[model samples]
Target: MTATAPDQDIALAGILRAQHGVISWRQARRRLTGSAVNHRVVSGRWQRVHLGVYLAYPGQVTRIQRWWIASLAVGNGRPALLAGLTALRLHGLRLPEAAEPVHLLLPAHRTDRDPPPGVVVHRTRRLSRADARLDMSPPCTTAARSMVDAAQWAFDDTTAVSIVAATFQQRLVVLDQVRTVLGTSRRLRRRPVIESAVADAGGGSESAYEIEFLRLCRLAGLPRPSRQSVRRDRSGRRRYRDVYFDPWRVQVEIDGSQHMETRGWYADMRSGNEIAISGVRLLRFPGWAVRHRPGEVIADVRAALEAAGWHGPSLSAGSGSATASHDGRVPHRTRPILPG
Candidate 1:
């Protein structure tokens, strides 16, 4: 039987009205009954988000859903973070159509008698000061830690690279921060490769692959090229390139998985035609070479530049992996163009 309004349960009405008539049954039960309050929940008046979680308002896009989950998880002795894809959404990294399953992380010692419903909880062993980060809300692992974690379990390399590049471009973390986090966790395997690339990839850098490719080129002693160089052609519009060797009139274009999309392909074709006819030697490098085999990438780049009438020493005194190993920071030193 429905627990109809009792003779003098005005407290329930007061609390409900106080919450703008949008309190949940769980909250109502806590205040009304000494042990457990009983009531029938209305369908339109109260929509069930999860099994026991309800939203009282008719059609409110409530931010309270996440908080409600957090409160419940915290009660279980594990202050959970609305992490992974969920955190990415909150940080405005993922677009609307790209939304995925919400990922949560909690300590292994959650004391709840039963696990929280509607959440996939990963029990992490520890969260360090570096790892612990604050973004849109509660403390979660910093973007660098999250990126390293994601890079390991990503369904695809493209996804991992995208997230990592974004974290760096957004200024959430840097190469050194990632390195330190990796050193502390010892969980991420490819820290050396990714951290090394972060230095070259700065703001406006398209992808992690692009960053690493540029880094390898720099270390290989190629003249540091201008990033995203824009020049107007006869059409009187802007044409951008990944890297531009101005004196050599060569433009290197790094294409990743995303560029394989229909629109990207179309744009690439158009830009390629335009730049090609403009007398710019267009060199394209696939993402795999940039991420995995940088030595090979450097070799190909040197070849392309040389073919583009660039006559320079194949091996420079400063050209080697040992150059970046000295100190992993983006060099602000003036890049002098060699005599062509």
Candidate 2:
């Protein structure tokens, strides 16, 4: 019935600006002309996230949600892109899991500034241009920067693999981009372990699984395999391999149910059969073998190598079924697959 107060509009806009959506009654009244404690108390619309922060949900807070929060938190707009686990997640990289203390970036001068609760701000005088590549998203880092950062900054193998896996999962990133970013990353010198990890990077079977497999091979100390290889036999027939060991004339296939496609299954078989005639030994392993049962898989590989005249040490055994000397999750259904 009353003409409503003016401060109420200003208060609402301020609340929206912060992205917290929820505002304290006292603060609302102080900032907004028409805002009143009684108004919010009477209205059932506000949802509380903390003592002061409110969120509108059933509607979720995405990166946009965080950006809105960041923008309002520091309206001046300094040089910060969400860094650490936050950036890694935004880039869709697979990490061991995730860490707390949402990371942030602020300029060098602000490095020592006290930040709002629940955010960790990293200070950098200069951020890599690559970090600004994907404007279409947010103030997030480029895919390659994200991957490089993950490889260098991740807590462990699981974390690094997850980040790289996530990077590839979001097909927006190309291999060339990853190579370009890594080629000049300053963090490169700080992370030698990461170099070995990236050396084996490959594409195919788009998921965290393959990334973990790459990490596993690195852990097992196996030679890095060539990705998406193409070779021809005497008849000029082309063959494709997920991974190729050119030195050993061997091809390792990491198969998941996805690869066993109705059409792909037959096509792969036809191509594989042809490659067999060219004197290349074909070795296929299931996704599970690389994951839960890597030891057995590793041993089987060593044995296969020995059989192929690889003068390496005897292999260790755990989940291998190829030799019938060990128990396996999926009994080794693969054949010796001798070369032609």
Backbone atom clashes (below 3 Å) for every candidate: 0, 16
**TM-score against native, each model:** 0.59, 0.55
Q: How well does candidate 2 match the true structure in TM-score terms?
A: 0.55
Over 1-340, each residue of candidate 1 has an lDDT whose tens digit, in order, gives 4455563357667654543444444565655552233233433555554434444555654443554444344434223565565555455554336534446666667544444445555667766554665433544556666767766556664566566777766666666666666567655545444444444454346667776666566556688788777799787987677788898888888887778999999988888898889887887877876766556666667788888787765464554332222333323233322111
Across residues 80-152, which tens digit of lDDT does each residue of candidate 2 receive? 4666556666665444553365566655675423345666555555565656633533355665666676555
lDDT of 2 at 3: 32
- Candidate 1 structure lDDT: 0.59
Give RMSD (Å) of candidate 1 vs. truth. Answer: 8.6
Which parts of model 2 have CA positions greater than 4 angstroms off?
Answer: 1-63, 74-80, 88-101, 111-118, 128-130, 174-176, 179-190, 202-224, 230-240, 246-249, 255-280, 286-296, 309-340
Per-residue error at 303 for model 2, in Å? 3.1
lDDT of 2: 0.55
